[model samples]
Target: MPFRINSQLAQLIEQHYPAVKTAGFHLSPVAGLTGESWRVSMSSGEMLARFHSPDRQISGADRRREHSILRHIARHNLGPCVRLYSSPWLLVDWLDGAPLAEDAFAGAAQDVLTQSLVKLHHLPLTGYRLDLQQQFAHYWQHIDRRRLTPAWLRLHKKMMRCRPPAPLRLSLVHMDIHAGNVLETPHGLRLIDWEYAADGDIALELAAMVRSNGWNAVQQHALVQRYVDAGGYRDLVLLQQQVNRWLPWVDYLMLMWFEVRWQQTGELKYCEWAQPLRP
Candidate 1:
């Protein structure tokens, strides 16, 4: 069983953070789909602490990967997320700005986000793997080995056959680009959680953000056009075609993720969401 932080974590906090003068401190649970996250309040300001459950299905390498990526982003002058400390037990940081509001997308914030992503794409990152095809295969193999539902398996296999647009230009992508993951501050937008960061089609991030937000087709088109304009002459046809091809695989990955969550929480809703998305 994963050890839930009850009293020991609180003691650890008092021992580490100087702001917390007393061992008895205020802690509030932060809502998250996976893992235990909290807002720890001291006399001065609050810090965010995220603890990955030992029972969660994440490899040690995954944690190391994110730690390295976050350090790199910090070094590159991205101000959204500030890394205070990282260890196997905790990831601590000063709280970021408020999450972008719902309407933040329709106004100047969209343009700002687009420009930020462009800057991110242009970063001189090397030595990282950007294998979308291989990732798809990994998810599919998990589905088969675990004997997932026939519907899900069928969708996985079908999506596996679809190919990405040829002539791929690999760049560092923020794989998870949702409103919640973005903070709108006076400085600019900041991306969080480098756990999913990797080199891949930048358009995949755009597609995932649009699809997850339920943006209309018009908005999706406008978003892509804006990115293309900022990016300087991207091939729109290839972008959309590749995005369409990857959509099914994205769905498959999401469903498998939910399955893993279900195994942890025994919640039917996680599996329920996967039903409609199944091919």
Candidate 2:
């Protein structure tokens, strides 16, 4: 189905760039799980427009916060430059790059990814803290408890028992780090989708990388070693422990997300994703 820009959005686009009224909007095929994006070809150049997902709040996403973080990161040339922001709509300078392939995690890409993350973690605090347990509970509230299997129930119990270490050192983390969100440009590897970025334990970021990338135990160790090599967190033993602690929480959050998405779209793929946890 062709995605047509609504009258309201079209008017907003015209208001910002009147030339768009003539050249019109060209929708990008790269639709995200939480937003519809487009590339508007103007007489001057190209601009990226995004319509944030209505279901964003269910996952505790704040577009304004994301915009603020993007602006901060753009200063360091890490993300796209923001041109305009209006409520759920955001327009930014279009980036010319390709999303990393699933198999692109090895070799130079892995090194670049590690260095990029280390750099991001070193950034000053953004005044946003991600409470994983709280987020889990929030998502759990929207899910039907009866839908969970004994295995999932056990996992949830285990996650409840685990906790972050004392006096946690928080850093700016891109919680949703994965191949899809990473773009390989001429400049370097740039991370997109700042909606889930916040101040959190660096180990949580490591755990997310492992889970989202489907890394094996060896691969996980290698990635962590690379991170450590790049002057990230010391204390390898404690770092591994922290990463382990976040694994269950990550899985639970994603499981709840899949359930909520299934409920919203009645999409069989979401149900299929939820089934493995359903015994």
Per lDDT, the best of the predicted structures is 2
C-alpha RMSD between model 2 and the true structure: 2.9
Best by TM-score: 2
Q: What TM-score does candidate 2 reach?
A: 0.87
lDDT of 1 by residue, 178-264 (tens): 777888655667776566677666667776777667677788778878888888227877776666655655665666666555555
Give a tens-digit lDDT track for model 2, residues 1-279: 123444445678788877777776654534642336666666777777766666676766777888888887888877889988997787788888988987885555889888889999889999988887787777777776667778777776666677744423689988888887889998888888788888888888898888776788888888888888898977778788778877766667777788887766777898888775453
Question: What TM-score do all the candidates reach, one by one?
Answer: 0.78, 0.87
Task: Name the 10 consecutive residues with the lowest summed lDDT in model 1.
Answer: 54-63
RMSD of each: 3.8, 2.9
**lDDT scores in order:** 0.63, 0.77
Against the true structure, candidate 1 reaches a TM-score of 0.78
